[model samples]
Target: MDAPQEARDADVSAIAALDEPTRRRLYDHVVRQSDPVSRDEAATALGLARQTAAFHLDRLADESLLDVVYERRSGRAGPGAGRPAKLYRRSAKQVAVSLPDRRYELAGRLLAQAVEESAATGEPVRTVLHRKAEELGTQLGEQDDNTGVLDLLERYGFEPRREGDAITLANCPFHALARAHTETVCGMNLHLLRGMLHGLGEETLTARLAPTPDRCCVRLDPGA
Candidate 1:
């Protein structure tokens, strides 16, 4: 089943309300859990007392960022068991926030520029985009597995869309930066992707800047 849209929106609002430290702790806890975490486990992982963990967990639950999936043994289950321990997991709906919103707006402008430039030059935008996408995909493929590459990309705000033998970056994480300084930002993205790919054991990838009237940027490719 899917979450109701209102509930999803509420979660986003709640996350936006949290302070950075609390938000970081919450995000880290959610990402690290392979399964629902018991209150005790969360406390231990965060080096907090059980009561303290419970407070934050409950707050997160109220915001719908977490869902109580089930009850579990507190390791003190007995013939006369007291309250059952609650296990918490991240909700299917995730909170979304664009920190420093100006940046995102800027990124949109930059992308528009790139698109416009391509159009003016009489080049097929899709063709140029696909070439760039392929370069990015090859760079990501250098990783041992798709998950590792995806994780790296996520940190940079580029979510990957995997197709049969290729991957497309669904979003540009640095939209604001890219738009404001196309050459610099695009080059940086290329360099960052190159380093990340190389660290994952790929040694035959290259990135080159391709200028379009709308946007000037680099494209990545597998070395011949």
Candidate 2:
């Protein structure tokens, strides 16, 4: 079944609010499992007591990061007397450490403006964008690694999607910035991503703007 976008967005927001350690623990619990896990299993895996696990598990559920499913289990009564335990499954949602959605919306608007300005100049949009991206990538590299780049994108409310060797900026990081200074802000993002790639030694990266209805952004080509 297809997942609802709103629900998935909520999960991403919820996870983004957590501290590093908490987020790590939560992600580890979900990603390593092949099936929905029981409260007992989670506690065991994390070396926490059942009640402790239950508490965090409930929080995750409340955040829509987890869903409760059921499986058959033996009852205390004699043979064939069994019921299903309330098992927990990681929600069909991607978790991210980022800002809220409203901010990202603003960033997109800003990018649209930048795209407009570049278009007006009769410059190939991609060329101008790539040049700006290279500048930003150089600066970002001075401060952090690839992982840091991912974190920065998340904090700015970008939903980062990673596949094999490629990373896509799924959401706009400069939503508020976009609304205030559209062109300039979008230009900055192009630079930022480029700087981030360069910092990560991904200088040979190739990025393509995603098609419409998705918003404006670039991606890293693993092969490059």
Candidate 3:
């Protein structure tokens, strides 16, 4: 699935924040340490002023690229410890973006689900894959009760375009894998979309394999 615009923008901002040399250095130093780094420790390690280190660290924390916590450096606590030092560590959040909106993460999830289900039920991998894909597609359709297939597909970066009565998918969310494993990927895509149509209560349209140059392997057309 396409990453939401807001999430994509935030990821871009986080990556852009690291373009500053000092910020990048500070980030690298913090992540490499076994423990979270205090601003003073980062400053001394990177030859940056303590104030500068604090500023960059706070920026990183704000962007959610780094996690922040407070701890007393002195072995003592309560009355004796001078103060809790602010520290920075790498955050668990992941950021990724592709220009054409590749969704290998989505593909991987489907494949993993297929494998697990097949192992458990002794079903063929292909059968499990198709079933899993359809389930996922139904889930996608359920996300917006008010939207139709075209709007839903567009929101997910399918790049749908009107072609007479049919809608041509201009971008495949699984472009690379589809190219490498055409039959399997295309079949999975076809079933997934059919499931989506079913879940959306769409009776007038149908999804079918209609591979063309510079576009997805599936098309949605009006049913008789």
TM-score of each: 0.36, 0.38, 0.93
| lDDT (tens digit, per residue) of candidate 2 on 77-140 | 5557677787877777556434344344434443465478688897766555546556645664
After superposition, candidate 2 runs with Cα above 4 Å error? 1-13, 20-26, 74-80, 95-224
Candidate number that wins on lDDT, 1 or 3 = 3
Q: What is the lDDT of residue 91 in candidate 2?
A: 76
Per-residue CA lDDT of candidate 3, range 23-113, in tens?
9999999999999899889999999899999999999999999999988877788786788888899999898878787778888889899
Worst 10 residues of 3 by lDDT: 1-10
> Which ranges in model 1 have alpha carbons more than 4 Å from their true place?
1-12, 18-20, 74-82, 97-224
TM-score, structure 2 vs. true: 0.38
TM value for model 3: 0.93
- lDDT for model 2 comes to 0.62
What tens digits encode model 1's per-residue C-alpha lDDT throughout 1-224? 12233544575678664655754595568657798888788888778888877887888777776888765465566676667768888777645666322225333444465478678887765444444444554555554454465465545455555544434455555665767776656755565565566555555544455543332244344562
Model 1: lDDT of residue 125 = 56
Best TM-score among the predictions, by candidate number: 3
Considering every candidate listed, which one attains the maximal lDDT?
Answer: 3
lDDT agreement with native, every candidate: 0.59, 0.62, 0.88
Better of 2 and 3 by lDDT: 3
By TM-score, how accurate is candidate 1? 0.36
